[model samples]
Target: MRVSSSIDSIYQNNVTLAQDLKSFVDTHIISNKYEKWHYISRIKSLESFALKLERGGISSSSTSLDDFFACTIVVENSTQIDKAKDLVNKFCDIKCKRPNSNNFTHKQSSSFEFDDLRLYVTIKDDVTVPNEQIKKIVFEIQIKTFLFHAWTIAVHDLTYKSDEINWGKQRVAYQIRAVLEQAECAIADILNLSKLPQLDKNNKETKALNKILNVFKNHFNKIDLPSDLVRLCSNTSLLLNQFEVKENQLDAFLKAETSAGRGTKMLGLSPYQIVLLGIFYQCEDKLLSVLMGEIKLSIKIVITRELLDFIQPDIRKFILDNSIPGIIVLA
Candidate 1:
């Protein structure tokens, strides 16, 4: 039988590891009631599954000769890293497979495994979350802030400066480091801001951000649309605007991609530009659906059946009543 890249969930250790990690994160690190954290293992597992076909087996894929790579779970904000600790445990089983002519060579194929996993624990006065359950030697959980993510983007761009290892990235590396420094500051700012007595309009950044939103909100309401979705939509718009997106029209946003845990995203179109005004983007339907087309949906349907299987019946019913068409699948 072909050694499967598939995560052997049937193994008791894997299950125990996942549950233990989940419990640790939910209890210790994600203590902030308002903060969000998630499990990003299945993503890693699935990608390794595909890659295992090319390598002789999972054995060829790692130093341990038995384990496979998994996916990254995202940290939604900048303050979660404050809760991250070096509390992870590891388990190694060397009875694994190895790579060969039959293995896949394409590096960008999978979103399942990342260099590490990040667990964002909320930084609040009320509770201290846990971080003890992680047990895979190959998997790492990071506690990063939003700023950390932005810095990562810049650092990634810097890594490709030249073929030379060190000197090639000299000038750009400074700017990359700047962005990382900013991430540290941003993380600190959010952490401090969370402790504020209350949010106020007089705040400089808050005011500036709110003013930006007001302009967009007024623009959105002129067309008669729901305002609640504006924050997410506006977040998308502000990012484009920063890039000097001269073309405000959604048609200009021909690029839409979705990662395993990232859900779905598009450039060029506001949620307003698509769903509110009625536009559609189409893609090739396959195991991976990101094949590009012109007919784009204003809003991509993010609710997949896999996600629905995890919800409580009562919550699922609530989502059915409130969620949009094609966004979530019904039970």
Candidate 2:
């Protein structure tokens, strides 16, 4: 049950390296606004490390424990999985491992297929660990979409670590997994369809929208908004384009409101709520009503004030013109 002292020593020595790698990964993820669901952890406890070594069939004396350190990045959809992989490749040396094949069928193992999206990264050079025996370190970065992560967790709990794995239960688990896989694909397709068309960077409307987005990003301290809220904002850009709200106009409005003590105080709002307010400010009456219906009365009042403060008379008239009776209240 006990791990060798050498293994424990390697683990203890490389803990700092693991933490540093986690921070590095976190920075990249946040800076790129890649995905909101993610976390980093070191391989803790001797039993887990020993189990990993046994699973990989590696000797305690020869192999270092660095590879056990890992971070999981959960993206919104399957498309972002590839994007996450590319992002990780930019900063670290990726170690490619060949798929382990099943001896009976001579096909790649199901376990390998399950983890095909994970990338192994390593610090190529030896890191100096003070008062420790470890010299080099390696870490894992796994990219998974939300549904895929759910499926994996379900499978792990039901099959891999279960006390008794019955054939009937295994069959049922696989069936559930298949349904989840299909659902994942459907969600990815929907996400792709909902995405905004790539606007030309040089276009005036594109530039204006970019500037507004930058302001919101800065205002939120560059926090990654939830994917659903981000998509909502993207959809709202169409209304911004229709209204021809220029960047300078938005900037002046925000400044004037803030200076006049009319801007919504953000202290009480979550980051998503703040982003939602920014998006709702640009929405037409119909779309605005849809968003308004989802929020609480307090949030609705705050958003209404922000909208009234920032929307110009002409833009307000445009929204009024497009308003549907009983659905939108302009007051």
lDDT of each: 0.39, 0.54
Worst 10 residues of 2 by lDDT: 294-303
TM-score of 2: 0.49
Report clashes for each candidate as comma-separated counts. Answer: 40, 0
- Per-residue CA lDDT of model 1 for 201-252, tens digit only, reads 2655454455545544544444444446546555545443433332234332
In model 2, where do residues sit more than 4 Å from their true spots? 1-10, 27-37, 59-66, 97-113, 124-135, 190-331
Report the C-alpha lDDT of model 2 over 238-288, residue by residue, as the tens digit.
434433545555555455444544333555554434433444444456345
Candidate 1 worst ten-residue window by lDDT: 279-288
Work out the TM-score per prediction: 0.27, 0.49
Q: What's the C-alpha lDDT at position 69 in model 2?
A: 61
RMSD to the true structure for each prediction, in A, is: 21.1, 12.0
